[model samples]
Target: MLSPSRRRRRAVGLSLAMAAMSVVVLAGCAPGGSDPGAPQRRSVNTRLADEPITIKLYTETNYTLYEELAHEFQRQHPNVTFEITKERYDVLLQNAPRLMASDNPPDLVRLDVQTDQVKDNLLLDLDPYADAYGWDRFPPTQLAPLRVSESGQRGEGSLYGYGINHSVTGVYFNKELARQIGMNEPPATMGEFEELLQAARDAGLLPIMQANAAGEANMTYQAILNQLLDRQTVEDWIYNVPGATIDVPESVAAARRLQEWAEKGYLNSDANSVDYTSMVGRFAAGEGLFMFLGNWQAAALDSEMEGNVGFFLFPPEDAGRPAIAMSTPGSLVIPAKAENPDAAAYFLNWTLTNSTARQTVADVGGSVPGGDPGRPLPDVAPGSVTEQTQEAFQDVAEGDGAIGFLTNATPGMFQNTLAPQLQLLIGGRTSPEEFAAKLQADYEEDLAS
Candidate 1:
């Protein structure tokens, strides 16, 4: 549902960008892009060569899902081995350009912010592979973020990557506490949601356990913004569409709503100081009744909270409107310079088709596996939050309400602009109007560079 990692992986989307900004990558990922020399296309034929082959995978995500996938795949192809290097998700995004340009590059890399990679020719264009693998038939919305136009804009163009799993952003509440408060069903609208927040607060529980250190208050803010605007408007802005903007009245209104939440004691008093890990840990420890987070946290929560937790999408203002959530696939891409392009392509195809691979992600990764959308879903442990996450994802995917995280509107936008502005807004130092204007300004400045 979002970039915030769960279990063994986490990406502070804004932190990744603010840190990545200092590296000075190619023409600042200018919309006017470059065409890199293409990797040789893989044959769609069924068999792999018998000779020993090693696929190099670079990722910041700790191997909860990856190590298992690699081992399981290697089991099937005895000759195939893996060399994987784990980096912090932030470091991985920061050094992406240089790593991809080195004399030797990884066969596949986990890419969170790929605009720069795609624009600079660091990533392999996957349209050819998509054709070979029948990936062209997968849900278009699931593939939209990975599709880059000739101008480097996302949402439409040749496919460049695929998510092994897709994520969803929504509200996670303590099921035990929910029943105590006489709430049996998820709120049907925003008004109903706010009432629950008030009830949780009145019961002396933290209504929302979001942290501001990584600017996580923005998670709730984006949840509200998701419903206020249509999917295309937000996705267009995040995809760097030529004139797309988020400094609209709806954005301002969303900011004001969050500010009011902060002022009214819905947010924890120490939210400004708490970090994401602590917040999630505290929530699972039973300190908070509800939290805003991505489905990435589901598997971990399932283990820690056991059967105590439940998740739901942010409800729309009107029940008749579609439910929208901040979501994007956890994208994996083949480097343009990958040593074994065909093997990498074949492995990616297997992830989509292999039953064991799909189930491992659901059971271990706590994520909703992304494959042929028409295919049956893999089984999850009964009563695990994973089931709800998968259902929420279906609602968003079918509703076409999957929008990129706002923190990803531009690298550094969160750290340099949104973070400080949100902190100030919560502290009574900035108006919501000022907050929206400042965000758009920073976005424009980043794109201009």
Candidate 2:
């Protein structure tokens, strides 16, 4: 019906039309075409960008991930900077009081639970700020330890510190070593645990690697004592309730039990001299069946053993009672002498709820309180160990029995008095009765002071 040139023109027009239609279809498949009214996505700035504030932070130990965290924080907050200072645990503890006494104390401080000394008058109450920032993301159980009584307030208290991570003290066992000695599972009772220790010794393996050189070595003995004595008895002994004495039956029994374990070769020969870092390495090398430590060492175990490590609740001694472990969340406090309390509060808020920051903490070998267990943790030992630790803590918190530790609950001076005395007991320098008497005398003196 048309000439050759006309036909060619028509073909070209049809091809172009089809091509245009294809483009239209592809355009529909592309993003943002169908929804013209859709809101533009905003980028989340996790750091204090453009904020003209600087906060000084003091902490113990060096962690690479924390440096990364600081960098990421700086990236998000271009105007905000951190002045960070790190020291060894003992040095940090020793310097904390001196720093707080000065006019230029650090804005943010990472304090040990036992050093509740500075917590009383040196830290600021964070109730209003925490409430304003919606820190209700974590439950009260996680926040209880950091709460302090406000000045001139009888019953009212406010959180002065916030902890990004928690540590649980418990027994870490080597599964391979356990299997070699026909122990496929962890001990559920103290008696069974003792038997396991004996078995490990018989197999020519060290049963327990205790780091007694560190002044904190007494922490282990305290943990053992907690299992033997009720919370009220411990509190009474610590507070020096009239006529209360560690020389009583309970303290004597706990000391004797520890002495028996040491005599039975349950502890390493040079345990009194081993430091914390060395103790961890020894356990990792399979030199021992079990080691008592905090979950702060989780990252190390994850990196070294991958999944060969397992955790157990402190085994129960009395029948019909559930076993539990000790848990203490590290705290971040603002010194009363802080030059920048407002900025410190802002940083605290940012750290607590920031998803990436929390994940970084978990990755670096610490567990977030009230965090989802299903989250991926790269260097974690095993989820099962964490679960068991959590379960034990929950039992202690929920059970009709009292829930707390003397080291954390008692005043700093009293803790100091007890630590060295307990160490002497462990080193076999003090008899059980004498150890109890010394504790009683210290408690009475502390209460009077």
TM-score of every candidate relative to the true structure: 0.84, 0.77
Residue-pair clashes per candidate: 3, 2
**Deviation in Å, model 1, residue 444 alpha carbon:** 1.2
Kindly report which residue stretches of model 1 are placed more than 4 angstroms away from their true locations once superposed.
1-47, 61-63, 414-416
> Which pairs clash inside model 2?
48-77, 49-77
Instruction: Give the distance in Å from residue 440's predicted Cα in candidate 1 to where it truly belongs.
Output: 0.7
Question: All candidates' lDDT scores?
Answer: 0.78, 0.61
Q: Which residue pairs come into collision in candidate 1?
A: 1-167, 1-168, 5-10
Q: Residue-wise lDDT of candidate 2 within 1-449, one digit each (tens)?
A: 12334223111111101111101111111122356323333222222335477778888773343444566677777777888888765567678878976778888888743324433356655555554455654656667666544232211255667776666677888888888889977666788888998999999988888776655555556667777877666655543345555567777887888777777888887877777778888888878888887666666676687667777656668656754455656677877667776667666665544557766665664454432222332222235454444434445545633334445434443246556765677778889889778766665555455
Which ten contiguous residues of candidate 1 have the minimum total lDDT?
15-24
RMSD of each: 8.8, 17.5
Instruction: Residues 1-449, candidate 1: write the lDDT tens digits.
Output: 33323222222121111111112112222122352332332333334667999999888653357667888999999999989888755457667678788879888888754566676777777776665566765777778878777776777876778888888899999998888788899999999999999998888777888788757788888999988877788888888888998999999999999989989999888888887778888999987778999887888899999999999998998987887888888888888777787788788878767879888788777787776655556777656798788778877877777778887777667667777887888877899899999999999998887
